[model samples]
Target: MSQNTFDGVRTAIIANKVDGIVREMTNTLLRSARSAVINSARDFSCAILTDDDQLLTAAEGIPVHVFGAQLQAQALRAAHPDMREGDAYLDNNPYVGNSHAADHTILVPVFVDGEHLFTAVTKAHQADVGNSIPTTYHAAAKDVYEEGAVIFPTVKVQTNYENVDDVIRMCRTRIRVPSQWYGDFLAELGAARVAERRLKELVAKYGVETIRQFVTDWLDYSETVMAKAIESLPAATLRNTGRHDAFDPFLPDGLDFGVRIDIKPDQGRIDVDLTENGPNVDCGLNLTEATTRAAVFGGVFNAIPARVPKNSGAFRRVVVEMNEGSAVGKPKFPHSCSVATTNVTDRLINCVGAAFAQLGEPYGVAEGAVGVGAGYAVLSGRDRRTDEDFVNQLCITANGGPGSAYADGWVTYGVPCVSGLMYRDSVEIDEIKMPIRYKHLRMVPDTSGAGKYRGAPSFEFAYTPTADPISVIYPCDGQIAPSKGVAGGEDGARAAAWLEDADGTRSQLPNTVAMVLQSGQTVHGFDASGGGYGPPLQRDPRLVLEDVLEGWETAEHATATYGVEFIDTPDGLAVDDAATERRRS
Candidate 1:
């Protein structure tokens, strides 16, 4: 074989090995982690990076977390100019590269042949971060300082293969759950070390020079794949508008957001300009630069499903420009970003997806809007059952996925940022751990966006606190501005939260609030579904009957929206083909 062919084969093998190593690292974290958020929800990410902190490959996790790994590494390198072996740094400050304070990151420098060659990084969402509220997302906080989360900006937590006692002591004193935090810290450390060992094994098998050459070739190949994908798209600029719920006290009516995507096929590049987006408001719903970039990249990856290697190389073909003071851009320091990963981030991601839908045909389809935001709840009080102090954040709100051309949207399939693997808290596990009783947990009816391909039905449920009144941290959206459908498809259902008193009275909850739930009072919530593709009238009559039979869509909704007539037949509920055609026509 020619030299190029040999190198290509070698590069492919090395890339696959590297990906496996990162996957192993992720698995190690999942297995070793103590917090339910990390282990149960799988809200952590692992990655291998060049010593200079360039993108390599990341294990499957939340897209935002994986993309932020580079920033975490850069922070470590900046803080310690001399990053010696056995040094491990931790940080969760958004200003310092983390998407939010909850995602504490661990950065370990990897050395091969006594020369620093790579950095193994892991970002995991900890249970608590000493925030003003017990939860990480303090939506009501006026500023970062008020949020009161311990902002570890490039702090070395370990040195010379030993834990830093002072740092650990400081964290222990500030957070409510010191043991859980420390245990998770160790888990992240373990994952990073796992990556280091795996990298060394690769280096030992193939000389350092050969491995380095493979990295270069792999990145080049990824760039070519991404360029070709962009080049294939028809030369068109698509501008899409979206919105966030009214949470900002300053703006009683909420805000309007917009994204202008300029696709230059000839240049093999697409520019996602968020400069025209709404101004940064006085709330915690703003997106950090890292979060913004991750959102844009999430859209690009969603648009290009081809086997384009996910690294710095593929990202180079997509240009994301954001206004410094915009909600989806660099916010001035002190603006509360505790809830930055969701809210505006989700809106931006949906906006990007909508823009791609404008491309049409193979390049695009009807817009399938992602969920408005993640549902967040903080349960803080003594666990009467265990007789222990407990404060935990419930991060599992199935942000219902949007429908696509290929298939129907999945019910409770995490947001675009998360790779659909972020698991919801097991209902049995939640009841066992927290003082809460699950009254109901199931999909709601008529919640799916209507079209030929319907979006997944939204999840709705109710629960009552069994112990002392616990603070309910509710940070969500999609109520005022529900997920819109593309082309002629119908819009999806809105997300909502409320408390029902024993007397059957109800009090609606705001988009972002830290409230209390009294005993005997039940809290209810619903995750908004995504928009569907194509017109509802064009949907298959058989699919409509199935939806009605499954109770996901009401008989009235099937008839009114899909123009399908379901008749009770001897076999069961059957679609009346003649009546359906007449109604559809």
Candidate 2:
């Protein structure tokens, strides 16, 4: 192959092939994993990295999980310089480049003809990480010691294509539900190995020389594409600030946040600066290096066109600056980042995405609902039905997504961190797997942020334990400052979770909740709705009428919020066009 040869067609084909490889890995892991979080909720990611530890491909992977994979791959190389053909590493150390402890990552380096070529990667959030509480999101943990989850800093878990028995034995000893964890572990490792085998096949089909050349050219082409996307936008240097609801005793007034985004349109560069931030407190709300970087990238990528490849090639143009000691910037040593993947991370994403509104119309998104609500609770106990211990992070109802200039919010949006990629599990599966029964799950009316592009409405869920007592824990957010609309839209509602005992005694739960529900007790929760995108008055009368017919809003609500009137005709309710126009004026 000539160095001058640049076949765009071949490059495209190879790109598709590599992307398919990643998707295959994802499908395998999801289908084979034993944990509900992996198989049902799909809280996992897969990717392929270059020999030099640069992110090569992460097609359709969750934004937060895959964006910072290169950093962990780099750490693996640093820890194990003497790399071999048949070895895999596990990384979950926040300080050493991970989003948090619960996201156990497996890395397998691909080799061909005595040369290192690529690495297959898979990252999955564990259902139970051996924390002080049943939940992995330990929002109140004061430090790493209090968090009480094992941490791996790019440690070897496999060698010579065999499981390291010591590492497996240790994990089985510590984690609750040893068999369940081991099964998931095998599935995740198998996914990576599948990618490794696929890479070798590609090498055999296409000569090594041509494949290597494709990597170089493909990366360069990806850079140009991203550069062009940024060039299409207006240059800006914008600053935005937001606050998290106070967690009593530690942050009474709550934690305040600030972000600066500088866009050099001509140069095709964007700089996200988080140096001017508050110091890390003792709680698990502090951001790890991985979460800080991923949050910024997630917000920026959402701001730009979705076509921009989320790989190291395109990432070269964007610069992220973080302070070591700041809560939202990077991890402070020994400070708990147990809840790093969510909580404050969600708020920062909203602030950064909303900052783009400074560029004016159609440039920014309204704030989305933040937090892993009670609907996504961590439930645990011995399953009386099966006489075995069980634990799972149920993905029942997702938080509402923010409305955009082009579309309304996604109804099943899990959280801002997930980018709405994780699926909400089926209710039937929950009943089959755990000893619990859902009472009622319905959408809350009059909770959406009314606008031309209306936000997603809040959802309320009610459930009761059927057999034995169950521990329920959730680290929720967005109660204090419910998602606020941008571009003159109305603000959305707040979230709440509470328990009703058998005797009808009610208790309002705090933001970070951990309690037990007796067999007769019920858990009721409502996740906040997302913010609207544009002025409510600008909404079309026809859409408003449809909303009334669908019972998403009453005719009176439509009149009050959208200035649309309705009449009871012989056949059905119809929009009173004349009255609507008169009321608008």
By TM-score, who's the top model here?
2
Q: Rate the local accuracy (lDDT) of all candidates.
A: 0.78, 0.87
TM-score of each: 0.95, 0.97
27-81: candidate 2 lDDT, tens digit per residue: 9999999998899889999999999988889998987888889999999999998
Each prediction's RMSD to truth: 2.2, 1.8
Per-residue lDDT for 1-585 in model 1, tens only? 124634777788889899999899989998988777787778888888887687899847578887756777777777788888888988888876789888888888998867998998899887789988787777667788888988889899888889999999999999998888888889999999999898999999998988878777777788888998888888888888777777757446776888888989899898988887766777677788889998888777766546687898788888988887777787778888887876677777777876787765334433333433324576777778888877766755676677666666777676656737688887776677688888887888888888778888788778888867877775667777888777666787888887799898998876776677888898888888878877889787878888898898999978988999878889988988898989888
Candidate with maximal lDDT: 2
Q: Cα miss at 422, model 1 (Å)?
A: 0.5
User: How close to the true structure is residue 534 of candidate 2, measured as C-alpha lDDT?
Assistant: 86
Question: What TM value does model 2 have?
Answer: 0.97
Error of 2 at 531 (Å): 0.5
Question: Where's the lowest-lDDT run of ten residues in candidate 1?
Answer: 365-374
Q: How many pairs of residues in model 2 come into backbone collision?
A: 0
